[model samples]
Target: MKKIRIQCALLTALSFLMGLSQFIIVGILNNLSNSFHTSIDHVGVLVTLFAIVYAIMTPIINLSVGHAPLYKVLIILFSIFAIGNMLTAVANNFNILLLSRLLTALASGPSMSIAITLAAAITPPQKRSWIVSWVFSGFSIASVFGVPIGTWISDNLNWRFLFWIIFILSIILIAILYRLLPHNLRQKKGHGFLRQLAIFKNTHIILGILIPIFNFSAVYIVYTYLKPLLINKLGFSTNNVITILFLYGLCGLISNQISGHINNRKWTKTLVSFLSVQAGSLFILFLTSNFKWLSLIAILFMALTMSVQNSPVELYYMEIAEQKYPQSLVLASSFDSIFSNVGVAIGSAAGGYTVNTLGLGYLGLIGGIFSVLAISVLLILNKVYFQ
Candidate 1:
């Protein structure tokens, strides 16, 4: 029991590092723009490129290596990830930085998918959802710790310094993981590409995967421009925005755990309820932006509802795979990470349009619409599968 607990904790830490690698750029975009002697928009392209590559490459890599020993695959992926961060730390020009982010995205997507599968493989069936929640909490915890700290590092020292830190941490984690993970760990070998493609034919799986797209689209619509939202619309100082982000992240982390604790049978209802509340929160944020305290309350409340659906969604994928599509279990694990990036890309782009056309205050209104769309999808999935 203790050994399994330690293993789960290590996987959670790996999730934290991977999440940090992916999101750290958000907080330090300004510093990156300055360091590369470019506009913030150019630097912003790195985010889009990363997400596109991540979403495109994740399933491909997972399918290619689905039969390989999990232990070796993990090490190779993490080593590549570490190398990507090192390149990011050392690159002198925009092109090199762009290439480095692409490399990191290539590794990050499959790495996280395998990590979730490994967490599930090593735990009891009953505890799978709980452990999956812990793994995901790593990402929320990154928001809690990683993004703010990266922002501070960028403000105080150099932006590249943060990448260097991540690079060093990645190396140490690789060694620790090698020692802890079992040599023979592996999943059921996947079907051929054409065979595995059949998982998408099921309407339940199709709708199940779409949940994250609308869910995260709603989030990043507002979240992609959170700093301006807090400062310009809500009358917060630059420094206070950082503090508010930390609080928001803390609430998100709390929400992840709270979602994990809900009974599995209740997941369908809980997910719909959470998304509904998220819509309400964003709508409230839209209406209350002029009132400082009320807007702040709405912001935190939205954060509280943000990550509550993650574990349940992940659990749904795994359960569906185990029950009906055992051959595609590894492939199943990659969907959330893949589609969630799709959501981020969609949301960020839409948020940009909203900012340009409707103004930043309208971001909350747009996000609320996506949240309702997510709720509608969840309800449809419930009717199709759970009903």
Candidate 2:
């Protein structure tokens, strides 16, 4: 029993670290650009590289590390994460920083995928949703606290210190995981990488993968350039901008918890309702950028929709994975991470271009259109495949 408790804690901590590593860039972009003597566009490459590497590596790692003991795999991955964070702290050149980011991304794919797999492994079938939600809540928490704290550290000290802080935390998490997680637990044979890839031949798997692509693209389109939009177009003070982001994060945290509880009860209706709300939120953001208070409200709603959408989408894919290739569920999660990161990179690139060319406010409009399109696709998919 105590061992199980420790496993849960370690998994949640790893989840938190994975999320913080991914998003800490959002709050430190200006500092990074200035310190590196580059433009924000150049700094954006860090995010792009991270996402691209994460997308490309997820499936490859899962395939290569087939049926390994869970503890051993986690130890190896977390050590890589620790090394990556330490390198980022001391990186002196832009190229080295980019390399460190790639290393971190490489580590992140397995760490996050394994965390989810572990949660599912330990929980009873009836409680799987709760466990998955508990694990993913780490991301929501990171959004609320990690971004703000990272921003504070970057502002008050050198940006290098932010990585150092995470590095220290990684060390502690590694120690806890080594001590607490079970050593004998192994992957089921059916989940071997090859079998997982084969499952993608199914139409449901294809649609499941595409849903994340569209959903994340819509979210990232506005999210990638949010700081600039808030400061330049919305006329928000830096402090206010941070505060609004915090609010957005908080709303997301609440929504994650709520969605986890409600998903098993009315999965389909919950998804449609949340997607509709997201569409509405994006439209509101497009129309109300000039009004500071209104924009804040819109962002809160957007956060709510995003948080609600994440778990259901994941659960949807997991269910399809179970039916088609039960053993390869972990591989499915890895694929999800890869595809989702691809979406993030594409969306960020698209959003960056649209903001530069069309106007920053246009980002919300673009995102809304994609959200609507994603919903339409899902509806069609549901009618044909799901039903």
Instruction: Report every candidate's CA lDDT.
Output: 0.85, 0.78
- Pairs that clash in candidate 2: 191-327
Clash tally, candidates in order: 0, 1
Q: Identify the runs in model 1 with alpha carbons over 4 angstroms from their true place.
A: none
Q: Kindly list the per-residue Cα lDDT of model 2 for residues 38-67, writing each as its tens digit.
A: 977678778877888898887778767667
After the best TM-score superposition of candidate 1, give how far the Cα of residue 372 lies from its true spot, in angstroms: 0.7
Model 2's C-alpha root-mean-square deviation from the true structure amounts to 1.8
**TM-score (C-alpha, index-matched) for candidate 2:** 0.95
Top candidate by lDDT: 1
